[model samples]
Target: MAESLDTALVPAHVAVIMDGNGRWAQRRGLSRSEGHRAGTRTAKAIVTRARELGVRHLTLYTFSRENWSRPKDEVALIFDLLVEYMKGELANLLDQDIRLLVLGDFDGLPFVARQSLAHVMAKTAHCRAMTLNLALNYSGREEILRASRALAQKCAAGTLEPESLDEAAFAAELYTAGQPDPDLIIRTSGELRLSNYLLFQAAYAEFYFTDTLWPDFDAAELERALADYQRRQRRFGKTGEQVAE
Candidate 1:
């Protein structure tokens, strides 16, 4: 029989690299937007499963900062989908007390998209349930660089001391300031690359890759990922013996 779902070893933070949407659509002879729409539905299911499995933080690789250069129509559809999704999920989010967080640089997005995101964030500020972080218009490298710039500016302005700059200090400037580093990062669609995702934050995260597309990733896949994470020993610089002890 299989082991009971890693209840004692569940990760507090889980991040996912949702990939293969475009390819999924192409294979199905559907519009890329349709794949994204299907992906959103999958997101809801994954969020529910994550909460059920005791995950406190769930981060999704939504839209990358680099995605702005994609086809104009595709980009527009993405924003439209985001707005519709927020409107559709608002009631359910409030009822379930799920906190919504949008990471990355938002300045490049359209005014309407920003407005929708801001509205949802403000309305969900009091939520106490699992935090759902959507990495919209985000890139990990850019995030860390921006944080570094902020630190430099603070020090130059005399608000922060030069000697106070350190790993913890820099980390505090990241968009995921109060959030824990991802303990497990799953990349779907068999992608081996990170594609500019959560570089600083996933320093020691265990990676799980699957051939399943974003829309195809369901509850069983998540359970499998968690199980894989639990079986591996995370030393974080310690020796195996030390970790075991």
Candidate 2:
């Protein structure tokens, strides 16, 4: 399926809101933990496929800040899975030349999880093929606020003038600073909302919503999304005729 895609149309950066893990498990009479576990496998497969398809950056909404409000046991399970994933995938990440990058407020994560993620990130830092970004403890609102605070601090210190700040300056202060904004953002399980993921970066992104559960979203599904994206004429606020000109 990927072979049929026009490589030129592939998004430079793809962001995914990996949803429906709990429902996937519930429907199968399994625990939410099981669903999350299955979702991790899908994540692994998608990362490999995305890299093969020439996506330079792939960001997964692994754990949101709001997710911490869930049951303690469920939250624990998620962190546990994260640790296991980092430990198990570090070698594969290095072997595939996929750099691991974490977005969001990572310092707020648990100690063991932070240690595991740090080790994997350090080990795979030199990989240049593609970047696999995981959004952990992430909140789009928080990210915006954090960046705003930094800018405010600079202004207070008289290092930056309020009137001199531009879009580039603001973006440089984001967690995704230096990375291309996602050209395509996908949400699985029919979710239509951004859920506070990449609010600033996704301002001009093409969104693809799928009913398929995260655990079931495969390479073929991704191909469909990319193919659809190719068919769209992104004018970026300009008229189609203007774009053609």
lDDT of each: 0.88, 0.93
lDDT value for model 1: 0.88
TM-score of 1: 0.94
Q: List the residue pairs that clash in candidate 1.
A: none
When summed lDDT is taken over every stretch of 10 residues in candidate 2, the lowest stretch is 236-245
In candidate 1, where is summed lDDT lowest over 10 consecutive residues?
236-245
Models 1 onward score TM values of 0.94, 0.97
lDDT of 2: 0.93
- lDDT tens digits, residue span 1-245, model 1: 12567576788899999998888898999989899989988988898888778888899998998898999999998899889888888887788778899998877778998999899989989997789999999999999889989998998899999997888899899999998999999999988988999999888888999999998998988999998888788898877542531
Residue 78 lDDT, candidate 2, scale 0-100: 93
lDDT of 2 at 44: 90
Q: What's the CA error at residue 142 for candidate 2, in Å?
A: 0.5
TM-score of 2: 0.97
Which candidate number would show the highest TM-score if scored against the true structure?
2
